[model samples]
Target: MKSVLLLSVLSAAAVSAQPKLTLKVHTGKGQTGYDVNSTMIAGEKDMLVIDPQFTLSEAHKLAAEILESKKNLALIYVTHPHPDHLFGLAVLHQAFPMAKIVALPATVNAAKTGWPARQKFWFPTYGNNIPGPDPVLPEELTEPYLTFEGERFPVTGPLQGADGPGNSFVSIPSLKAVVTGDIVFDHVYFGVPKDAARENWEKTIDQIAALHPAIVVPGHQGPGATDDMSAVTFMKRYIEDWDKNAAASHSAAEMKAKVLAQYPNLGMEYTLNDRVAAYFPPAAKGN
Candidate 1:
């Protein structure tokens, strides 16, 4: 029994010490994602980074893993305005200043409008546990512009869609895929907050699908087809259900039962329960 207990303790320690697995999307050198494997393009000199992982510790660990491949991480592309895919950047930037921060037409514009408010609101609920990066104050920097999107964007006339359909794109012809931001989410959870509109999100996904990328690197989740069709399908279904219930219509208990009944194989533990409570109406207790 003592021997068995010792072996179990060793096994647990080994598991805890194992660094998080990263999915590498490119055939190139050390350029790989630390967690969900970011898509990278290898140049003669440097490599371009897709979205970094979500937390500071995750980013630090990811960086150490990349150094093992013996390549320099050059640019960072912020996929969209969502905090999960884009927040690790502040610390990453401080670590790799040479790397450029790139994005779409309204990417930062959306963040500029939403992040401050979200930071304020989310702090009350999640702040105490979140990894704090002490982001460089927004104004302390001059944001970069996209080369394809033109120095002064909203390129009028035929490309008016730069902010919409005909949005600007970044291509590392060598890689055969663009690091699409939140334009694509694979087998993962997706719930939009006030800053993001479902319709706008859908539009971006449609545009990404049009790109015909062989390996589309979504902002979150593991790398997959840029045209991952399932996200669109799942999102559409959720929207339909959400619309039917209309935020305030369902009581808490009914909401929980409805979620369990409909998505029996869905969220485990308190996560699903919390989302229901946070996003839905209160239960008619003792009913």
Candidate 2:
């Protein structure tokens, strides 16, 4: 009886020493919001969601998944200020009122300042699929890292990414995983606006690669994309291709064609359109 009791105690101790956190990703459909990835990092009793969704309906679906998990929703961390990453805060807040939604100060400010313009621009296209006028914005996160079940998940950056600047990503050391906001994308066209600094963005990708994370949850990915270093490799190659093609082409259409020919199967062609337009806007009518 004593030997059995000793073995039972040893089993419990081993279980207690194991890592308590696990991660699950909920990716949007390819046609919906460019297959944006929203990850749920769950501890033994509580969980944290990173980057909600673009549409209210999709957010509802994400909320349902969280509900099914049966873990307390402790926090929601917005990775960047883009509407696609943050527009669903209202739905999530309504569903999990107790969860504290937070982001870096820069992200919070950009979201608040860009909300009106973003709503005006996307409302017509999304039509009632998005949140109404008064959406819930995340509070400014003052801490350097997030804590879940006594483990530290460090928040790094405000660095330049495909979406421009003020982009932050979260790292789980125990998991050797990084929840990259727009810093990385898997088999998806990048959103490179007019003001984007390609050099800086490349540097950011290098920084992430240096970490050698096993799991990389990008801001966007194609269907069946794996969470691995392949995304980082793709991002670097895509940026190099963009630079080479952009320099060779005389018009936006030419640039688009070149890029498309190179990455014919990549998702989010709309992003490529935006990228070319930003780099090669049509010449003035008089010219």
Cα lDDT of model 1 by residue, 122-233, tens digit: 4565553233434422221133332321112111111112112323334433334545544444433334322334455555556656656555554444222233455456
**Candidate 1 lDDT score at position 206:** 64
Give Cα distance to truth, residue 5, candidate 2, Å: 33
In candidate 1, clashing pairs total 5
Clashing pairs in 1: 23-37, 30-69, 33-38, 79-181, 252-283
Per-residue lDDT of 1-287 in model 2, one digit per residue for the tens? 99999999999978876767899998877556657889999988999999998888888999999999999999999999998899988889998999999999999988988988899899888889888777589988889898788888999879988777888889998888999998888888886533447678877878877888999999999854799888877776777788799899998889999988998888776667777887886677995
Clashing pairs in 2: none
- 220: Cα error in model 1, Å: 2.8
Deviation (Å) of 280 in candidate 1: 3.3
Our model 1 lands, by Cα RMSD against the true structure, at 14.5
